[model samples]
Target: MSPVAVILTALPVEYDAVRPYLTAPEEITLSDGTRLERGPLEGTPWTVALAELGEGALTTAILAKQIINELAPEALLFVGVAGGLKDDLQLGDVVVATKVYAVQGGKLTPEGHQERPESWHGSHRLVQAARSALRELRPDVRGHRKPIACGDVVLTDPDSDFAARLKRSYNDAHAIEMEGSGVAHAAHLSRQLDALVIRGISDFADPGKSAADSSGSQELAAGQAAKVAIAVLRKHQPAPEETPGPIYTGDHIDFSGGTFHGPVIGKQSRP
Candidate 1:
């Protein structure tokens, strides 16, 4: 069997972008009625299982765990579009998360909010593979390896309370999204699987976000993110399966009634 990988998206547009890269996909319905598509990724030694689990951190965490348990993929990737937080990140640019922060984990107090930040780092091997893949991509498809902030709400106003909180706490995050941290946490609990979050900048997390979405930036960003994901798969080499050795029940061989034609070497015992 080919090595398996899971690519999860949070929206239909993101799933549509990735679906085209799968060859001869077959629908798989889980016992819980969750649907997924399984097929070989074009020009790679990977069999990809794809799912779109909708939005929100909690929902993503639940469905991601379900998929991981069902497929047992070598790696899991959450690929989709995100709102750019940095000035350098332009629309359609890709961001491969080196670390994902659950930005909403904090406590409100009289002295103000106290941050209890939680984060998960991306797999080092996967990050290296993405770096290599980015070099071969189109010049217009800019890529960055940076930290991402994940929360429950969709950020539209840069001056919103959540946005201000993000700036004060997760200042290093380059992109804001709704699901990466959930999937990252699920993979972390699995212990044996490597996972990464890749997103494309659809809009700046500002009042202009609606205009950007109206101009189809979301679809373009989704496609760009999916392209980077496929490229990473092409550059990555899965670990080879181990071959089982023959089982030996005893330390010594017993040839009790064998007729030997040649000189047989054995320990002679006195009858």
Candidate 2:
């Protein structure tokens, strides 16, 4: 089988975690067929692009589409760090997104769509496969293997109200993060066929904690997340059975009375 294409912003810690599993590609090419001249992980098929912090969903989506056009990879994985929405999660706890929710677009009312932030989609089987693989290898790595919370807008804020809103909006989500929704949106738009967005909570997102204070913490969490994502890709082949699951339907979600109010309400979210 051909190699599954993976894309991510080269956050140092995450690069280190999955470095061991990556097979360093032989040549390099950009979406436009222009050769990438320089990068830490250059000259390899498993390429890394520099998407500095806060590089919103639209930018991320463009990059993903580029990869799809150039690489045409079977699968795409977005591995990164996220703020822990749940209290049980500490620094380094991994939360695999059972679904990616983009809350940027308009509200999805049954009657019609209301104005909201722009949003996108993600892969659950990839989440499950990654969790399964991680458990198989490092049982110590805690896997909050459930539907994860995601959005196109930045969920990072230094307030409890934001956390409360996240909790209220995405009741089924175990954690919240910034990049998953954007990357997931790119994959969905480009028709990548199969895509995955996996994140780890580096910080608990305590209203009291400063984002800088938790830099080291988030990196460690991202490292763990990268490990699980790579393991999932390695062990699970892209078979028809392997890829079976629901279509992604969300971008910043809201669960009211145990009902999903995003793009697609998943079974896991219902009960």
In candidate 2, residue 178 scores what lDDT?
60
235 in model 2: Cα distance from truth in Å?
1.7
Which residue pairs show collisions in model 1? Answer: none
Please name the candidate that would achieve the greatest TM-score relative to the true structure. 1
Candidate models: Cα lDDT each: 0.91, 0.60
Candidate 2 similarity to native, TM-score: 0.68
State the lDDT of candidate 1 residue by residue for 1-271, as single tens digits: 8999999999999999999999999999987888999999988899999999999989999999998888889989999999999998899999999999998777899998898999999999899999999999969589999999998878988988888888888999999999999999999989878899999999999999999999999999999999999999998888767654444343443488544344334443332
TM-score of 1: 0.90
Give a tens-digit lDDT track for model 2, residues 72-185. 666677777776777677777787666776654556688654545333445655655676787786656887765566554445563655456566566667776666676777
Indicate the residue-level lDDT of 233 in model 2.
Answer: 65
List ranges where model 1 is wrong by over 4 Å.
Answer: 246-271
> Candidate 2, residue 82: CA error in Å?
0.4
